[model samples]
Target: MTNVKRKAIMVSLIRKMKEKGSWTGETHIQKCTYFLEEFLRVPLNFNFILYKHGPFSFDLRDELTALRADNFIEMEPRRPFGASFMPGKVAEVLETKYSNDIDKHKEQINFIVEKLANKSVKELERVATALYVKKNEDVSKDDMVGQIRELKPHISKELAKQAVEELNDYIKEAEHNHIIL
Candidate 1:
């Protein structure tokens, strides 16, 4: 996949983990990645999403299965979530919400350290992406909101709504793909 696509999926998955505070399974990662590419305009790695971070209370496999059964998510590889959802109006004024507002969003994501665990470092990287975007102006509110609404059918209305806000945070956090490390 193109670097742009890969980064897009990474941003979406990370936003999901932060918004929900956790996620599980290869499929959920796959599902999130698929929609992410469409909405965020990026591609993803399912294996990267599955790589374990640490022992955690939540079981990724079980959560993925349950979420799928509940119709809250889908696992399609290349398909975007269905069309029942639309990102609502952008908040009247954008403001910092999650993660302590670090002088830099990267600083905040790095703060995510090992207290809680998800399946991958990519997840951490994704959160970093949101932080990067929130702090930068590369992504507009309209673009971010459009991406969140794309998840409407597969993810819940409430979840999608929340995701929109989370996307804003994620976009705020996303760094330029070519920034020198």
Candidate 2:
């Protein structure tokens, strides 16, 4: 799109976001980001960003970067969104993705978070165990059997079984204890 057209789209997005804090529709968001990167290049600031088709808003910079990927927003060199109004569960995983520790696991964690949001801690443990099984498949058949074998002394099957049963509970307990760190 031409610069003028991009500007027009950005202006339109700005008007919508100003009125309701977001714009919805695939073409709108993609085109909006296609322009926003340029608009933002001027060091100008706005309270809202047109995140996507989800009328969501965020209040951070890094978060904007994740949501503004090439496929998602068509922006380059990236910009962190200043605010988000995504649903809480969706927002949480997005926040965690920008977090330092497990940043790389954002996508997987987001999917799990979505699935786990509706479940009890009891259910989460079942899920975690199931996921562990799938993720660990072929440790004996894949390439990690030797390492697993070497670590077997430190990792007992019995202990792991117990852990599978108690994982969700433990995560909850740790959270209750203020131990997420």
Best by TM-score: 1
Model 2 residue 117 CA deviation (Å) reads 1.8
Error of 2 at 84 (Å): 22
Over the stretch 30-50, how does candidate 1's per-residue lDDT look in tens digits? 434332332343322322221
Candidate 2 local lDDT, 160-181, one digit each (tens): 4544444445445545644232
Candidate with maximal lDDT: 1
RMSD of each: 16.8, 18.7
Give the TM-score comparing model 2 with the true structure, all chains together.
Answer: 0.20
Model 1 RMSD vs true structure: 16.8
Q: Estimate every model's Cα lDDT from 0 to 1.
A: 0.35, 0.33
After the best TM-score superposition of candidate 1, give how far the Cα of residue 120 lies from its true spot, in angstroms: 14
Clashes of each: 23, 13
